[model samples]
Target: MFTSLRLPQPVIDQPSRLVLRLGLGGGLALAAAYGLAFAVPHVSLLMALLLLSKPGPALALGKGVVLAGVLMLLIGSGVLLVPLLENYAVAALLLIGLGLFAIFFIGTRQSHPLLSLLLVSFTLIPVAGVQGQALALQVVHALAGGVILGAVSGTLMHLLLPDLRQLPKAAPHKPGVEDAVWLAVRGVLIVLPVLLLALQNPALYMAAIMKTATLGQQAGSLNARDAGRELLGSTLLGAGLALLAWLGLSLWPSLWMYTLWITLALCWLGLRLYRILPTRHPPSFWLNAMITLVIFLGPAVQDSASGKDVLTAAVIRLALFTGVALYAWAAIYVLERVRLRFHPAGPRNGVSTC
Candidate 1:
């Protein structure tokens, strides 16, 4: 019926080229993600989703971008309601509880729970901290960042390969309901420490992230050695990239040149590590580093008014990653021992029971 349509033959004959093009498109999209996330306030949730879902095949990538954009818009509008709702703690708790309940009732039963989880978890909450016109600014920034990341990435993917729409679905893994719950519980447990850190020292956001990871059976279940190795691999990769970026900036002051050097270097490192890693651990780590480094550098380096001190921001990010990696390694190591001592049979024994 649609015989007038002409499909390009290049896509069928050269999938590799298509993937590469899409990946580059994905990279640019990720860059947008980094920029908007830090500049925007609460919309960081969408940024998190984009980072988490980037490894998926082309179809999933498209879905993620669309989902993120929709979420960004919804969240952007939702900010208007923040003023009507008073009491930050109460609002936060209510939103989180309702979001989780919705997830269990509606999201969990679905075949693709990850998307549901991302949307629910990220957009579920209202922005907290202050109660005036500033709220609008925060909301706009947050949603703007996420929306830009999603729209840009999705559009870029479409332009680069045009085949992302046709990618195959991934095979399903066994639904670990018990494990997920346990992991969620652990996540709750870990939040205590982060709360403590916030109360005691707000500067420990990175530490809070690592310490929180330790609270759950999710991260706990990975092989102890593998987890530690992964943390090291990922962190070192970030540090190396940061160093390279610093060098590039030192040599060539142009923002465009800096972007090219940093992006290419990070991608090369990520691809190389992916190829050489004995297991999937290093690749995962490298991927994490690549995602985070963009956030770490964009404003810190780009904002000329922030004393124009690139070295300081670079150092701060490096330290943050280093400290977090150390904590992550230690936590994973300890959890492994606990698993051995208590649930000797291993994670399959359900000792890492979420």
Candidate 2:
């Protein structure tokens, strides 16, 4: 339904090669997931886009996707072991620890393994005791579907358009293990208290997960101005966009209709997302907003009309964003002063080459 004339001028004039690949791949993955009734279709497009968005060889992308997919399955399945912690607080704390550790292994520099994507695949798991297995299985299946299809699409594009230009990338040095360890320590100290506190409030838990995942992504920049803007602006915009999707679907609900709607939205928003990027993997502002829309509003399209869930999610997201941003900025500010005051010996910058 996206006719040529309806597309934006930037899209028509200077279409991003990576964006085009992501859109085609995500759209196809979405169609397959919906058509086949995948367990967690909502994740299919997101995973596809995430994996395929990196500017690299198709084979390299495929390899990373496979590695990440296996990691996703392993991590998701590990949720089954959460009961071992006995205390819910202990479980949350352990999970936070696991998240921070992996966050280091993935490196916190300039987006090597991509911390945000890594969190969704491994870190943001729900510790629902026995049900954790089922949740994990669902996540793995959804991820598998996306990665497999997205990789295929990327490979195909590479074959067909060998001359296609890739996005410019910054080659930041890999962080030393000691630097990574220190960063992990900082991450745990900052995140553990918040994680425990968030666990106390069911409504606040998801927000905490979102906030922390975002924190990991922004760790490289430690730019409060950009991070705050991305967090607040994207979340508010995403919530509003989700409301629109819900309203539209509520009026004329149909399986095919909603599928088409989501597909188109993905394409349009994805293109927009790629166009606004100031760096190779800087904060994903509009994409985050679109994700917020899809994740929060997608369900309302099917559920009976009530503004309660959307409103609650919106508030939680905003509050947690504010809280997390404050902590991140405060931590960064103090760290800068310390480094300046006592020039500690380690990696000069926080970046990952992975």
Candidate 3:
């Protein structure tokens, strides 16, 4: 429940309030994550941005801590599969698939955005563990830290720029059982290939897992017609944004500059996301683009720090991301056609299927 604070009416009435909250809050989280030198600092930054994108009030500190603990517990649980993965690969893969479907089904039925986070942890932690248990533990720690960072940044933003008038929150749309099942299936198909690929080289495909997990969750909300544009288009837009940001950072390579650049990018996207900038695209489009931007840029930064060829690495990553998006688009098209053939009638209760 968001309550209005004693703030000026101008700030309350202007849509820029939400944009500012998203931009500033995200920037603060990014700065803190990198400043403290957390493992996979970009993960923390991405989590914070996602949290800030939610329309309602920030989670209380206590709840935030609890969420962090839950994230650690859930992600850390993946370590249990390491032995199975090494010993009984077939059974382990099947188990992971089942778990992914269950999580996607629950999230789709409930219309929860945190599904992306859960999906990432579920898919990423186990795969990373296959490479090494230490890497898996690091992934868990990074995600938990990200949750805490998100909570703190969200709370601070709310306090500093409280929404003086509470807007009516839209009731979440819950799909029918059949729709939920189909959507969850689509979500699984979108991620499963990438998950399998990541199992080969978890170190390189870690970011891909993150991107695919987001795509899987996003696919649930998209129709077949819009799947290509929303999925592939956003990936390209994000890649472009990351390229530009990397160029800007090159001009003045400093943490302060990096923070500023990221903040500016977030603000620009926030304008579109909050509808301050007119656009035909939905808010999810911009949100995905923002996530894409971070996903692309984070790895580039790591590559540069590790003395790798940034341009070549970025190009390769872009290609991989594009391939994943194209696959997601195709999966949606094929699945929707199959669903239509069987049912003849489309989704009931006005629920759209992918």
Candidate 4:
């Protein structure tokens, strides 16, 4: 009976399995998010993509539940700051800065993507709350829903496209305390300015906060020499893909078409990210490009549905994202220079070992 129930295996290799998982899982997440009309639907798709990026078994049900709970708790914690932000603006900013530093420090010391999720929660939630308590609550719900959707889609994909063999995981490098501190400081500098700006007009700059969060994670992995190319290049690549997708979807203008475009793009990027498609660019480049594509495309879709000027919004968002990327590159460069000036014999290869 078990043999009769087993499906034929079309994905035999690890790379093919990974690509299929990303494509199918991302499409399912995207379809579900928009089909159900969840608030901030793009976020759910983005979470799914992030989870699929890790080529391994799906998260267990028990762990997924715990992760969802923890994520909700962390993200909801931002609501507590709404009053503090209104009453003691200066103190609130300082406290947020310190929190950012600590989060980045922990991320640098331990190489895990959970840190990115934490950074996004810590940064985006409070900014949303500044606009209104209701909006903050909505964001919390959206984030928690995204986490659950990602876990479910990822689990389904893994079962459908299981790897033939499990590969041994590599041990990640941990930066020393001093190096971690420096990297953490750099990440804080990259994110805090944007967060402050978002506080001024949370509705307008909310998307920027998300982009900045991605930049902060990207900045942590890059050295000065490679920063500009990797940062700006990936942003541009994502924008170009978004444009192409928009044009393609405009011709068709249907939900299925949108999902198809997204799935195809993810498959292309996943091939590069998993090294199935040979390229000189690092996996980070492809990862960032895929993320940027989602971020850009999601908003455009919303604008169209709401009768906003999609083209104008896309152009403005592209410009804002470019500015953020430029700032991140400059911050990384300046910080690296400062570190070298003070510590003449420090490691010059990457921001942190991992």
User: Which ten residues in a row are the worst by lDDT in model 1?
Assistant: 121-130
- For model 2, the stretches where C-alpha displacement exceeds 4 angstroms are 1-15, 59-69, 87-99, 109-117, 126-132, 152-170, 173-182, 189-191, 197-204, 207-211, 247-251, 255-283, 299-354
lDDT of 3 by residue, 1-354 (tens): 347556655535447888888888888998898899988888878877878887678877788889889878877888999899889989988989998899888886665446667777898888889888888887788888888888898899889988867878776678888888877788888898899999998877888888898888778778778889999999999999898899999999878888888999999998999898889877877988999999899888988988999888888789889988999999988988998899987554423221
Whole-model lDDT for model 3 versus the true structure? 0.84
Q: Is candidate 2 or candidate 4 better by TM-score?
A: 4
- Candidate 4 lDDT, 1-354, residue by residue in tens: 686697776546888888989988899989999998888888777776777787777876667778878988887888998899999999989989998888888877665556667777789889989998888887787777777777888888888877778877877677677878888788889999999899999988888898888888878779888889998999999999999899989999998999999999999898899999899888888988998999899999999999999989998899989999999999988888888888986543454312
lDDT of 1 at 282: 32
TM for every model, in the order presented, reads: 0.64, 0.71, 0.93, 0.94
* lDDT (Cα) of model 2: 0.57
- Candidate 1: count the clashes: 3
Model 1 ranges with Cα > 4 A deviation:
1-19, 30-70, 73-140, 164-167, 187-192, 199-221, 269-282, 302-305, 339-342, 349-354
Best by lDDT: 4
TM-score-based ranking:
4, 3, 2, 1
Model 3 regions more than 4 Å off: 1-14, 348-354
Among residues 3 or more apart in sequence or in different chains, the pairs in candidate 3 whose N, CA or C atoms overlap within 3 Å are none
Q: For candidate 4, what is the TM-score? A: 0.94
Clashes of each: 3, 3, 0, 0
If the candidates were sorted by their lDDT against the true structure, best first, what order would they fall in? Answer: 4, 3, 2, 1
lDDT of 1 by residue, 1-354 (tens): 789998966543234433343345545654554443454421343343334334343434556567656655655544544543444655654554444334332222233424333432233223222233454455445544554454455455555545444556555343356544433443343333333343333332432333233222134334566666666566666567656676777686664565466546544654543353244543345445654554455445544435766666566656666665566557656655775687675444222211
